[model samples]
Target: MNERIEDKVHFTQYISVPSPTSSGRSAAWLAKNWHLLNHLVELEATTLSVSARIEESIRGRMLNVVVHLCNVEDDTDFTELVLLSLSSELVKIQSISADYIEREVRCNLRGRRVTSDENDEILKEIMDALEKRGVRIDYS
Candidate 1:
């Protein structure tokens, strides 16, 4: 009997969070004048742009997002925005963890551990969407 050696490679994916052209502008406006628009700003507006990475494995990918927020009193609004944006990514979420780092908040959203077969199909779709949205991604 012969054992097959695992062909392993570490894929480090990088995504940049720029102020979204159309949506960013709207969000910014709301953030600045949230006090005026009583019903406009749903959340407290703690965050704006988010930077994340996808570490791919034989099973599934892990997503780590660094959430950035404007200096405000609370983060309820910002967190909602972050989650909404991420939900559009179509990454099967497994777990979510968050913490504060000085002025920025780091929210690590890990994807459901999947097998290589599932990954091969969903990986490109998610990557393409991110790329199309101007979220620069680099895999190595």
Candidate 2:
């Protein structure tokens, strides 16, 4: 069967890292650190500015780090390096995962759509880093 493949476009992904109760750090505190943000920029992982927003839910204050990847191709590498850099800061990382929207678009009979999968290598590295620090990773 002959089929045409559609090019996949990379969208913005959101990664949430919950604050640790023991660390006594608030979302604002972490956001102001700027160490991780600066490091990522230096490595050229992302040209997009990194912003940390604090959300107040029933669970309390949550730190959500938004990483804007300049190139979708660098998603995996960017994520891996960010997590690693954050680890060295002794920041308590609760979970690391991407938030993206999935939509279905109509295609011609000869066209097929392909989407990018989560960066497994980076995910694994983040998992290991979290585990070593006794932090929990959000796989869900």
Candidate number achieving the greatest TM-score relative to the actual structure: 2
lDDT by residue (tens digit), candidate 2, 95-134: 4332210111111101311122323333333345445545
Q: Per-prediction RMSD in angstroms?
A: 24.1, 23.0
Residues 1-140, model 1: lDDT tens digits = 22222212332322223355669766876577556444322222222332333333334343333233222444353431122233324344322221221112212223422234433433444444445544444352
TM-score for each predicted model, relative to the true structure: 0.21, 0.22
Candidate 2: misplaced stretches above 4 Å? 1-80, 83-118
lDDT of each: 0.35, 0.34
